[model samples]
Target: MKRTTLSERALVLAPHGRDAPIAASMLAESGIDAQVCTGLPHLIEELDAGAAFVVVTEEAIASADLHPLSDWLEDQEEWSDLPFVLLTSRGGGLERNPAARRHLEVLGNVTFLERPFHPTTLISLARSALRGRCRQYEARARLIALRDSENRFRTLFDTMDEGFCVIEFLDGPHGPASDYVHVQANAAYERHAGIPNVVGQRLRDMVPDEADAWVEMYRRVLMTGEPIRFEQELVATRRHLELAAFRVEPAERREVAVIFQDVTARKRAESELRELNETLERRVQDAVAEREAALAQLHEAQKLETLGQLTGGVAHDINNLLTPITGALDLLSRRHADSDPRSARLFEGALQSAERAKILVSRLLGFARRQALETRAIDVSSTLEGMRDLIASSTGSGIELRLVPSPGLPAAQADPNQLELAVLNLCVNARDAMDGGGVLTIAAEQAVVGPGDAGALRPGAYVRISVVDTGAGMDEATLAKAVEPFFSTKGIGKGTGLGLSMVHGLAAQLGGAFMLSSALGDGTRADLYLPVAQAAADPAPVGGNDAIRPVKPLTLLLVDDEDLVRAGTAEMLRDLGHVVHEASGGAQALAKLGPDHKFDAVVTDYMMPQMNGVELAGRIAARDPGLPLLVVTGYAGGNLDVGLPQLAKPFRQADIAAAIERLVHGEKVVRLRPRRDANSAA
Candidate 1:
């Protein structure tokens, strides 16, 4: 590798006539690059710019009163010797002149050279002078660097954000106990300690109590030879400070240096923050109270709106049933076949009409109160397929409806009839949105929202079905209160506005979120979510049981307060070939079933004042271990609490048969009828 090292110049500043080049040549031969400066004025700039040496001639140096260069040379380190070469024609005579000798005597290191000398003698004097100058350069560079470094250290200490201070040992009885005297302190440190003119003072004299604390701290540090840090608050000033101290080597002895920073403002800010938090907590409590009151008002409004929707659903379904009946009756009346006397066929038609009327009555009761839910694992897609014709007919010819039902949708646990009603409400809402003529898109898709979602949805997969309308859309403000009870969009007689609120409440009870998105001129979309049912066991296929032998008939108790319903129901039971016992109400029925009579099944209505179906079922279940009790009613409220089976009213005769068979067999049914769950499976 190529040799590389930095070579320094040795400059010997002297007058032009003194043969500086000749002197430099001698030093060059001695392996020192020496140059004599032309003037004293340029010495500072040259030396600062990294020049090495300085030399002066005797005639110029002795007569030169301005000793700027000499003073600068004296400030150098002790190892430095700034050499000066003197040229003398009469050497001994020069020494004899008292004034000249006095000046020369003071300049001790300079060599005297007699003129008319040999090159060897002249070269030796110049080389010796240059050698001394080299020593001066080394000393000056090191000391000056150290002096400049002190200013750097002071600048950093003063400019730091944290207050800093240095304390030195002092000479006194109190000082012996104290850590050190306060020798240096930054501006912030002085203000915090409340000590003025802090430098070069005894710590104990300035701050007596603080001095005692420092004594205990310093003693530990000296004994352990380790640094210590502590945070404390001043009792008098209530100022918080962080104190740090360590052992350091002083010029002549070992001393401990301590630095303390004030943290009072930070502590005060934290206190204020805690106070703000308390204020915020009070505000939150007030808000919660207001929210509870609002919810109470909303619940009252919902009760009234629910009554309105029941009336509307009743009116709508009755109107639909009338179309077929009225048509058949009109045809019969137009024929005028009196002699034929169509009694049997007319009685059958009357039965169908009575069945329709019964359905309307049960639906009315369902709306007046809550209804008993007949839950089952239903194929919602299939049910939707059944309603395809009804939905199309329900909407006007002007509205274009696109029913995009998912073909392979998962099975949802729901009451098929109730779910049908809820879906009909959605379709009605969509039709109302498209007043003129527009496409209403109802699409179903599977979705998953996990934790960290903005809505904070539960971690599970859900079926999301959206009813999208290309019609007059709602604004953001309207969308926010869209699901509020009794919040109507249509004018006075046109709507009760319970459509969305009911949808929301029902969905919430089913453990799901009800979401609505709409923008002016864009569209309105409602997203319905429902939790998925985990298939804990394989799905059991419930096949038609025509091949299996029927179980032996046992006594069946049929109970109802309504005379027409009991009589009509008894006729239907006798037609099915069963031993039946009829009772007017729950109390009369219980007296008949008392000990002597053991019934295979008990079918009763839920909303009886004397003895409710639930209460009767509970009494019976408490009394008998294995008797199967089937609760038949239109009013089932909340969740089911017992093992008794439930069946909603307004059913086909076939519906009664299927339910009784299932209860007798003790088949597992879905909990409460989940209309919203249908949306999930779809």
Candidate 2:
């Protein structure tokens, strides 16, 4: 093998240019590659560039500023211990010089030699220092490999398909390992168990019902040193659980690892399959019965699918028609300026009717799964209390209205306004059902539901609000279709049949459940189950009338296909002190904006012939990246994801002004009252 070189590459810090070359020659003879640095800055640069060792003269370290050298040494990692050699005079002046002594203390691994020292001695010292440095490099390489291995393991643990946890057996006051503490767990453990923040918690404290049995099973595993696998019911979540537990061998403490999954759905499916087989045998004896059963199921499925498609299409078209009408009303309101009382009242009545129509459309669309909800934490007791007067009026003198609220009930996580609407709808239905005048009770209470208890709802704490009525109850068949849209027993023109359907949609969309129970002669009880909020409800702020800010004159490019909408919007912009330029389409707008021509901002409509707003934005970005763009849309299906500012149709003058102000002044303005992205998943 070839001879190994000492300090394979070296950096010399010698302010004297002539002394640097001499040092390089001495190191080169020993097959070491060496470079000379002229000053402290140059020396630091060379050290940062990865030198094996640093060599300097006593005069350089003593006379020159050594603060930089001190800082460089302070920044090194524990694994890094760079070797250095100092050439000093024959006198032992370094011990007496405080500055030199301080520099020596800062540069930890430094060796010194007199001027008359032998070349072999210097070379020998370098060889020893290089050997120690080689070990450090080896240790660093091992540390990096260990970190990579740990990251890989953690990724696999977090993405497991089943729950996994490590439990350490704990001793009770008079029992042998009667409980266990969860020491470590993966992300999937929380998801599969439907429990969060489980680490460091004892099993007995978390679920007292199953504590004894679960502890006994693990205790057996530890005693026999054998693994056990079984399927059993989890009492806490009421779920059928399949798990395997084994003692961790050679561990210092008594520990075991458990792996499990909730198999409730599988169990239910198996039970249904068995029941269907029994029914098939009976139907085989009567062939006509089997065919009729299959035919009825298919017909019901197809009818619902067809109705949903038609309703969704009609709702979209109606919303489009309402957009322009609402926008026109806004402009008219501004023109009237609340100066005439008669005109103002007429305007207010029309606006209220229009708003009611919008809510009706929203309910229809919501039942069709084409609407979004704005969810928040709301106090159930307070919401019911506020509606006491309205509920009493809705029942009239015929029925007695009662409100009963449970004490210390937690707030529910839902949209406050939507929850109010759901409660109101339930009350109306109850009142109509009790045609002969009876008692109507509305009550709210806290409840805990488990995995397989509440249908289609996960295990958690909930706020259950019930509305009971002493009414003429419906039969089983009618009760089954109570939540179906457009399914009603009321006479023609009596109701639209969307009350219960809308309530059901509201609960589902807000991540809750709705249930209705009734009998032919008895009363009816409707329960709305909403998840309990973890935090207190936020207080609603009261505000006075908003004062509009005056806008400075700005040159703007406005693009839209509709002449009426474009004209109305341009008039509004002009009123705000802006000089507006109109373009009927995106192509026309681009032509107006040539290479040399520019404007303050571009405002364009999303749906247009030839080129849409998003495409226009892309072209503008390519030409002038700094120019700001805003897109307006009347169509409901626009999917512009360029992160440009957007305003929905039917926007008031203040809405558009706020959107523009956000773009120009870096002020945060709330976008047109709570809109979910059209492309977002329901």
Best prediction by lDDT:
2
| Model 2 TM-score relative to the real fold | 0.49
Q: Which residue pairs overlap in candidate 1's backbone? A: 11-53, 12-35, 12-36, 13-37, 13-55, 168-181, 371-636, 372-636
TM-score for predicted model 1 compared with the true structure: 0.41
Off by over 4 Å in 1: 1-386, 405-419, 450-452, 531-559, 585-631, 637-682
Q: Rate the local accuracy (lDDT) of all candidates.
A: 0.58, 0.72
lDDT of 2: 0.72
lDDT, residue 538, candidate 2: 68
Please, what are the lDDT tens digits per residue for candidate 1 over residues 1-682?
A: 1211122555555575656777777668767677567766665445544543344455555566546655655554443444545555555244454444644545545455555443545444554444445544544454455446555556756775555665555445544434466666778776775556777776566666666776677766755668777777665456777666665543344466566656666655544544543443344344445545544644554345335434532332333333334334433432343444575357446645645564445444443434444445666556666777888888778877787767666655544555566667777887887778788777766678878676735877766667788878899878888898678788854677767776776566556667888888887888777555454222333421122234446578988765655665665455456688998887798799887887888877554545666666655655665667777654333224544576645444455666777877757532223233222211
Which predicted model would earn the best TM-score? Answer: 2
Clash number by candidate, in order: 8, 0
Q: What CA root-mean-square deviation does each model show from the true structure?
A: 46.4, 32.0
Q: Cα RMSD for candidate 2? A: 32.0
The clash tally of candidate 1 reads 8
